[model samples]
Target: MSFLLGHFNYLIVVFLMMGGLWITFSSRNYIKRMIGLALFQTSVGLFYISLGKVAGGTAAIVLDKTSKAGEALNAHLSPDYVARAGVDGVVYSNPLPHVLILTAIVVGVATLAVGLAIAVRVREAYGTVEAGEIAELDRTEAGPRA
Candidate 1:
């Protein structure tokens, strides 16, 4: 069940990415294009999140779990205890992906805002929000200008 859940998360990310790509290419409306851009950015975020997660492993911070009530806890947790725990003395999961995702999220929002702004401008100038109309108007204008 857990494996499926893990894979499902990544699969959904891929699905979202493909949906966004399809929308981005298939839409004629500026708004729809912007929606697709936003979806694509969100999908990328999902990808990063999916890549960063570690199954069954807690965050890397060593939470002073050493018990003070008994010396046995200290004895067991000595250097030997770390060696027995397994590879590299700790199963520390890489956090770089998480950090990068945080930055990417901020950048994604900015990109969406910029895209929407351009879409609004396109709609204003062309008197229509459709990509087809905007392209048509641009072509007509260019034909005369040249």
Candidate 2:
């Protein structure tokens, strides 16, 4: 029960990845192919973001104004407070994954842009942008048989 819910995002990420891959590989339409690429790329971004999240931890940025110079890190919690606290108090999402996701997001955007540009070119060259049409045209251009 708890385990299933904990790993739910992984399932979503897997589904998204497969769906995107299928769209990218199986489609014939130029725009459709680009759409699939976008989905696939976004799923990657989702994967990274999912990894970076910490349950109750604060954001990763350091304080510029509030901290006194060279203040030692220390804290004391009463027994009741310690006993009542869930894992949230100790859990911190990995900052590295979040940073990686940020880069991946930028890469995804670039990929989407390139894919769209290619699709436009394909449409201009083929007259019809449908996948089957493009393949048929390509086949016909290659040669004809009786």
Candidate 3:
């Protein structure tokens, strides 16, 4: 298990995505479907975060001048040691995915709110939120199609 442990986040991502998909597809209630869509959106965000992570990585903060000076002193002591240290320098995880995910989350919430609002309107108009019932009502109201 080290490999399994290392990649566990991906498994959770898949589970969440699949669960969301199931709810969205199988639920008769529009609200439940919207909740599933939100769940799916969350899973997508998690997936992006997981993919953007770097093992043993830190934030992409710039090193201060003092730290750079200390590193220079250490480098002069031993070239080989400095070479190794340089190779193992602070690894930074990518920030773009996290930023994009933040934007996506805002968009997802807005979309969910709009969807719920529409669902509310639909319920008011049709007296129910079940898609099948709404379709039946529509058919009855429309009569036979030529």
* TM-score top scorer: 3
Model 3 lowest lDDT segment of ten: 81-90
Query: Model 3 over residues 1-146: C-alpha lDDT tens digits?
Result: 99999889999999999999999999999999999999999999999999988654445564432476445544434545434443344345678898999999998999999999999988888888899988897878742232
State the lDDT of candidate 1 residue by residue for 1-146, as single tens digits.
Answer: 98987599888888999999999899988789878988888888878877876543335554343444233433445566545542344433457777887898898889888888886776666677886766777778542121
lDDT of the structure predicted as candidate 2: 0.68
- Name the best candidate (by lDDT): 3
lDDT of each: 0.69, 0.68, 0.79
TM-score of 3: 0.76
Off by over 4 Å in 2: 63-92, 141-146
Clashing pairs in 1: none
* All candidates in order of TM-score, best leading: 3, 2, 1
Note each model's CA RMSD in angstroms.
5.8, 6.5, 6.0
Once superposed on the true structure, which residue ranges of model 1 sit more than 4 Å away at CA? 1-6, 60-62, 67-93, 139-146
Residue pairs whose backbone atoms clash in candidate 2: 28-131, 29-131
